[model samples]
Target: MASYYLWRSKFGGLSVPEAKRLKELETENGRLKKLLAEQVLENEVIKEALRKKW
Candidate 1:
């Protein structure tokens, strides 16, 4: 337990609310990254379709 707290504080001594906010931010970041990846894939598909001689 002591070692755990020591490691936790070494990384970040965030309080309860701060830790909660950090978790929320991390979740939001992950969601946004996934959305951006999907959008980029869609754009690439569109570009490929447009490039084909029709």
Candidate 2:
């Protein structure tokens, strides 16, 4: 119990609303990263296709 409280205080533990917002932000970040990665892969494929000789 003491250790928990100490850790919480050291990290400035989030309240309910803050925690919820943090979770939402994390989810959105993950989604955006996935989209960006897909886009990068598509771009690489296109570049490779263009670079091929006839």
Candidate 3:
């Protein structure tokens, strides 16, 4: 995609280690986001179930 190319160009000057670190951080960020989303969904389900009980 054009946006991807544009982003790559912006980071083209990064050293190999910098690029590797960036990738690691991105992966961790994605994992944390997924975990947060799952927790939110579970909370919503629990709330709904409690509402029905009362």
Candidate 4:
């Protein structure tokens, strides 16, 4: 969000260190989102399977 950019600017005006950290955080966020999405998909599949039997 906007707060993130403001914090980054205070550190070093988006210098190499800030950029590297940002990239690392972004990658972590992406991995987490993917994991969450996969879980949701699995839940949906399980629900559908149960619905079919019931």
Clashes (N, CA, C under 3 Å) per candidate: 0, 0, 0, 0
Q: Which predicted model would earn the best TM-score?
A: 3
How do the residues 1-54 of candidate 1 rate in per-residue lDDT, one tens digit apiece? 999888697547788888888889989999999999999999999999989946
CA lDDT of each candidate?
Answer: 0.88, 0.86, 0.94, 0.89
Q: Please, what are the lDDT tens digits per residue for candidate 4 over residues 1-54?
A: 999788766665677887889889999999999999999999999999999999
lDDT of 2 at 10: 50
The TM-score between candidate 3 and the true structure equals 0.82
Query: Which has the better TM-score: candidate 1, or candidate 2?
Result: 1
Off by over 4 Å in 2: 1-12
The full ranking of all candidates by TM-score, starting with the best, is: 3, 1, 2, 4
> Which residue pairs overlap in candidate 2's backbone?
none
Error of 4 at 1 (Å): 26
Clashes in model 3: which pairs? none
lDDT of 2 by residue, 1-54 (tens): 999888577546788788778779989999999999999999999999989944
lDDT, residue 6, candidate 3: 92
lDDT of 2: 0.86
